[model samples]
Target: MKIVEERISQHFQLYTNFSMNSPIRLYVRFVFVHDGMNGIISSDKRRRVVNALAKAFSSRFVFNHIDLNDQGLYCPDYFRLLKDSEEERYIKAKTQRDPNVYLHIYSADTFDGAKYRNWSSFPWGLEDDPVMDGVVVDYRNIENEESYHWIIHEVGHWFGLVHTFENGCNPPGDYVDDTEAHSDEIRGCPPEGIHNACPEEKRAPINNYMNYTDCKDTFTLGQIERIFRVAKVYRPKLLEPEVCIPPCPPPM
Candidate 1:
């Protein structure tokens, strides 16, 4: 991990204005390698998942697919795969042209119903601007057709959106002007600001992809626009691609 940090620091230094942009689009590629016991997810499923993300952000970024699962572990090819994927490549690429690309590593693991706890969870997904340059998600808890929903929520974090509730009322609140300034963290949908009942003005966005769920779902346009703004400021390299069509922008 020291090597990875060294590489990222070196790149970050080169692009000093990374945080200045209000909406920086970032480009990223994913590499799924078999680790151990519970490992990487399926290629086909991941492809569809990535596609959904691309659509969600629309003009905000680009996600390139460079399949490398056929490669072996511990080999030069494996090491090369790490550097070749969007995490390293995007960082290196961004440093060369601009200062807004961030590389993040994603992987599957046991959630234990808590935030990531160790080096294994070091680059845990962010609620706002969730996906930096890369992120790994474990589908173990997500079963059957629900895998898509899981990926969407985790990826939502990659785009910079935060959980509607977690810990306590924090600063910078979930950037969306409409989301209430929450005071606590919640898992299964709690009633509005009320942990147990519905408030007259607000209720938990139980249907929101950001909240924990037992159902399949969709993201609100307001949520999409917020993430798009975050991407433009934090991930400019991703926006470089020339996309002919933009997915329907989420409502604000």
Candidate 2:
């Protein structure tokens, strides 16, 4: 993650004036890995989950398709931290079937022994291995209302946004000037009040989607700009309209 952050920062520095004339429509697909025990998520749940994601990103993402893989593609541990052999097999089996898919998310019944509930590959980090591009989250994250933010947070990273507490409140933190720097991530939800943590005593960005707080719901103006710039620079394929399938939904 640190390596990816550095690459993103450097790229942003090089393309500081990058801008997009129009918003890009994202085609997304969902794959449910059957755990052979808990079964796959229901259609109603899938719609609600897609709705939540659409709401979060202002409807830039389109619901493409849902796939149920009973071929044992489950990620028992952290998806990104899987052993080389396991990772290769998982990526090969979960490979994107639709050429129009800009992003693919996989959900499993358990990431039981993993330290984190979800993982996503940064676009800039996929230069060496593009097949591993995707997001993985525990199935409970989609089912439980309280953990819904986890999906948004991981997607933020996929869009090139980093943690608010990145680099420990130092210069170039998160590479977004509008986001206030913090020494570390604020765990759980805290009371509604001013939370200052940087040396300059600026208010912490507890409400930013890239932050670890449970109440995170919005992205700063600078973060939004950076997201577009990153897409244009590192993931230009996402900006090409020809790559997306027909009937792209209008923004919500």
Candidate 3:
């Protein structure tokens, strides 16, 4: 999209300083909300999600400032929370928060009022609204490997990736040079050589994070580059050190 390309030219625009080969290290704060009676998302699940992110961003990002929050039993009204203004709620909603966290993520009992298992800060590339930023996921999906990529996919959007079938592969589509054009989304794990509307371009990389495909695991070079560009333009804080990981205590 034009939004992504225009961002490439914006201020905080260190498009040149970026080492072409090195990964951009970023810090993440994971805040978990639950009934005090229930356990937080297990370490196993957390580790899996972390690992998936590492692989997906291997060439572009490194995550750190890994931390957790135990906000017991705050009921989030997912439907209105998403459709209406989210700022009234989550902007003041962080608990056990770390000011240094660059990527603030959460795990709750449900998301989108259970209509959708997960939700994330899309269009964050459009502006800076801390409360409205970051990702929120259902507790159970965080534990399921099959579903966990939902978080990674959402994060991709946060950094400015459009769907693989973005705008039907129209000009400036997905704004990535390496990914193929697709007319629509891939609903689930598609078999190799599945139908592609843009046969003129090679088959779509259906497994890309921007797609709705179930087996997704890749981010094109263009996407990684765009992510870095967008971060500088819209989320420059990610490059700064607000807080480093452990040995640091949760905010009181």
Candidate 4:
């Protein structure tokens, strides 16, 4: 991952010009890779994944396109792409130049051969590698209902959200004020009642989408505000009126 040397304070300057109440319609383009090793994902499964995303995003997501590429191009070495630059080349060649469409790639192979489920590029946060612009999910991670939150978690990162436990209980942790500070992620469903670990003694954000817990569900107000701010600054094209078509009016 490329290291971004930017500070959170510098990135999220106070700005009231952009309205926060309006819904944001995010356009997404999915590319499924069939490398013969894992076979192609069924259309039903694909729809289910998209539905899950829509539910997670509160119906603010739009599916622009779904395409299957049977080039058998797999990134076996993961990060070492020189030997397997075909996959990179394919992505670069296939990626649409339109900034409104966010590209998501689904493949069967693990990113690091083990313990790696998914990867996403933060717009202007921690990792902002220009080459790695979208989100990539391993097929194994999306096989069950329990793992559906993984997509939401990665998407949160793509929208400039760091982990809930990002700065280890320090100031500017995850750059969100509402979410409590924690030293590390709380994996799986945390037990009922207050679960505080950091020095602040506040309850950990076990249910936040940016957290690693299994019961992930909501994004804090701060996170939502930050997402809009980040989009306004780093991804201005996404907010264009032309990018999202207005809904049809009801009968008069």
Clash counts for all predictions:
35, 0, 1, 0
lDDT for model 2, please: 0.68
Error of 4 at 208 (Å): 1.2
Name the runs in model 4 displaced over 4 angstroms. Answer: 1-14, 37-39, 59-100, 111-113, 125-129, 244-252
lDDT of 1: 0.44
Judge candidate 3 at residue 85 and give its lDDT.
42
Residue 249 of model 4, lDDT score: 20
Q: Write candidate 1's Cα lDDT for 1-252 as tens digits.
A: 344334444655675565423333443334433344334456665566656666654544455443444331222222222322454344333322112343233443434355531111122222242333344444352223445556666667656666655423554445454554455444653444444212332555555566565442656666666554444444434445433222322332
Candidate 4 per-residue lDDT over residues 83-147, each given as its tens digit: 12466545645553344345455445545655556777677632234555667776655566678
The candidate maximizing lDDT is 2
Q: In model 2, where is the ten-residue run with the lowest total lDDT? A: 76-85
Kindly list the per-residue Cα lDDT of model 3 for residues 190-228, writing each as its tens digit.
Answer: 785646747668577777888888888888877887777
Q: Choose 1 or 4, whichever is better by TM-score.
A: 4
If ranked by TM-score, best first, what sequence of candidates would result? 2, 3, 4, 1
| Cα error, candidate 2, residue 107 (Å) | 0.7
Tell me the RMSD of model 1 versus the true structure. 10.3
RMSD of 2: 4.3
Model 2, residue 150: C-alpha shift (Å): 0.5
lDDT of 2 by residue, 94-192 (tens): 566542246777776546475666888787765666666777777778778778888889988888888988887677778888888888888778874
Clashing pairs in 4: none
